[model samples]
Target: MELYNWMVEPFQTGFQIRALLGGLLAAVMSSFVGVWLVLRGMSFFGDAFVHGVVPGIAAAVLFEFSPFLGAALAALVMVSLLELIHRTTSLKEDSAIGLLFVGMMALGVVLISRSDSFQGSLTAILFGDALGVSWADVQMQLLFVIGVGLMSLMLYRPLMSLSFSPDKSQALGMRPQLTHWLLLLMIAAAVIGSFQAVGTLLVLGLLIGPAAAAALITRTVPRMILTSLILGMISVTVGLIFSYHLGTAAGASMALVAILGFFLILTIRETVAAIVRRKRSTTLVEQGAS
Candidate 1:
């Protein structure tokens, strides 16, 4: 009973309940987005999107506006620029990402430095404040999940085709170009939806870690997404509980746990593969000797 109370006591509070809900919602939404990011090899694009939103959030803080709105706008602008540069210029994808990432992050720093009002919330913007999440924030995250989920379902076929073979998708009349833009929109929504829970800086861990872990264990896309969601939820729940008991930063704890899950899965998978390979090699040598 003492142990149960120790584990359950923090969630009894209103703020902690809100934090749990917010984190869970963010986790589910991010896992779905992370699956696509991992499949499409767009992890760098996700990272760029995460940093691109920083300037918008900084501006929002300075003006006392909605951070989500600012983040969405910034993400849209960055994605558009990336698309334009990649399509129109001779620069490669990596160059475009590097150029935009540094520029946006530097702009955010400049904007924040110029503002005195943003000092109080600067840490929260960079590192997140899960405990500070409010009911309104949870509501917004719910809307984001619903909207993004519906869009993903509608565009599932085209997105899948684009992920595996853009040329083939184009041949199938799926218009890979349009699907690509829609994917960018979905990524932007996911990043903004999760930003308040995990912050822009550590958001990549939440976005990529669980999906990477799930991919190693699951064979199909749906299974991978489901597994990723489970991993993400567990990470948030355990991280929050540990943070409450240990008096640590909740957001950082969650991000760390998610990353730890990826590494744990990787280690287990590699070990199993090594054992299987050794067995096969032994069998082959015995047959040759026979």
Candidate 2:
């Protein structure tokens, strides 16, 4: 009974329910896009892209405009700059990512510093206020979730081919470049839709952690995605419950849970594999002795 109450208590209020809905929506979209990011080895690019949108979101906060538009425009600029640097310079993609990562984050701080409520606004933008989620926010996130899901499904073959062999994708007429751009767009959408719930800095946790954890035990992409969705939801639920009981920041709690969950899954998987190896070795020795 106490355990049941503990599970039910955090979501007793309207704001709490909204927070759960928002987090779930964020998880759904992030999971759909995140699997591909992991497969394509673009985790660094995804991190930079998340930070890349901060200036736009900060500007929107200061100028009283829609954050979604600001984030979208910033995403376009980030990708364009990344592509230009790759095409025009001898520097590697990682180098370009590092440059934009620092530059965009610093720019965001500078922009946020201009606000009258600089500290408050910055905190909210960086850490998020999970309890402050509104129904309107939930509605917007739902649309993003649907769009991401559809795109992910549509581009699965191209993305899979690109991940394994870009040359093969090109040979197959998959248009690897266009598929790559669409994946970037999906990542941006997930980050933009989720930042309000988990913040841009922390949204990467949900974006990567769940999918990474799922990768540990799952071999197939479909199973990995399903496992990631389950893990993401668990992280959100457990994080919120802990936040309510322990007086923690909801978004930070959730992000932390997602990351910790990854390590836990890793530990368990490794331990199980070791035990199995040991058992097999022991059995072989016994058979040899006999």
Candidate 3:
């Protein structure tokens, strides 16, 4: 009975229920978009996209506007700016990403430094307030996840091609530039939708961690995405449980769990590979000696 209560007590509250739902939606949404970022080697872009929205969100808070709108608008501008700078200047993609990421984050700090409202909300913005998530927030998360999933289904083949081979995709008339922009838009949408659940600073953890873990174990794109989604869900659930029992921050806990999952998988994969190599060497040596 005590064990049952321990398992079921945290979920008896409305806020906890809402937080769980929000986390689940965030998990699903991040998995779909994150797998592509991992395959494209654009995890840095995803991180930049996450931080790039901070200024917009801070401005929105100051002016009493929608954080999601501000984040989306800012993210689009950042993506366009990255493309523009990369195209016109001698700067590389990583250089542009670093410049924009640090500049925007610093700008956000400056903007927030002037406003008391931002000061109060700063922790929530950076690490999230999962306990404060409302049912409306969950609904929004659900809609975004569904929309992202539909887009992934519709654009799977082209997006996959673009991730695996952009030059070949362009040669096949897939319009690599347009697909690239679309991916940027997808990343922006994901970040905006997720900021409330995991915050901007930790959003990259949810976005990259599960997909990276799945990549080590899966050979195909679809399987990788599915496995990432499952792993993400597990992370959310386990993190929520830990947060409830230990009174830890829910968003950070979730992100940390996802990252831990990635490292755990990586370690297991490396160990397995090493064991296989050792066994193969031993077998060859024995055969030669015999």
Highest lDDT, which number? 2
Runs in model 3 deviating more than 4 A are: 1-6
Compared with the true structure, what per-residue lDDT tens digits does model 1 show for residues 17-89? 9988988888888887888899999999888889999999998988879998899888878987988998899
Model 3 over residues 106-139: C-alpha lDDT tens digits? 8877777778866667777788878888888888
Q: Model 1 — which ten-residue stretch has the worst lDDT?
A: 114-123
Better of 1 and 2 by lDDT: 2
lDDT of 3: 0.88
| Alpha-carbon runs more than 4 Å astray in model 1 | 1-6, 284-290
| Candidate 1 accuracy as lDDT | 0.88
Query: Which residue pairs show collisions in model 1?
Result: none
For all candidates in order, the CA lDDT equals: 0.88, 0.93, 0.88
Task: Identify the leading candidate in terms of TM-score.
Answer: 2
Every model's TM-score: 0.94, 0.99, 0.95
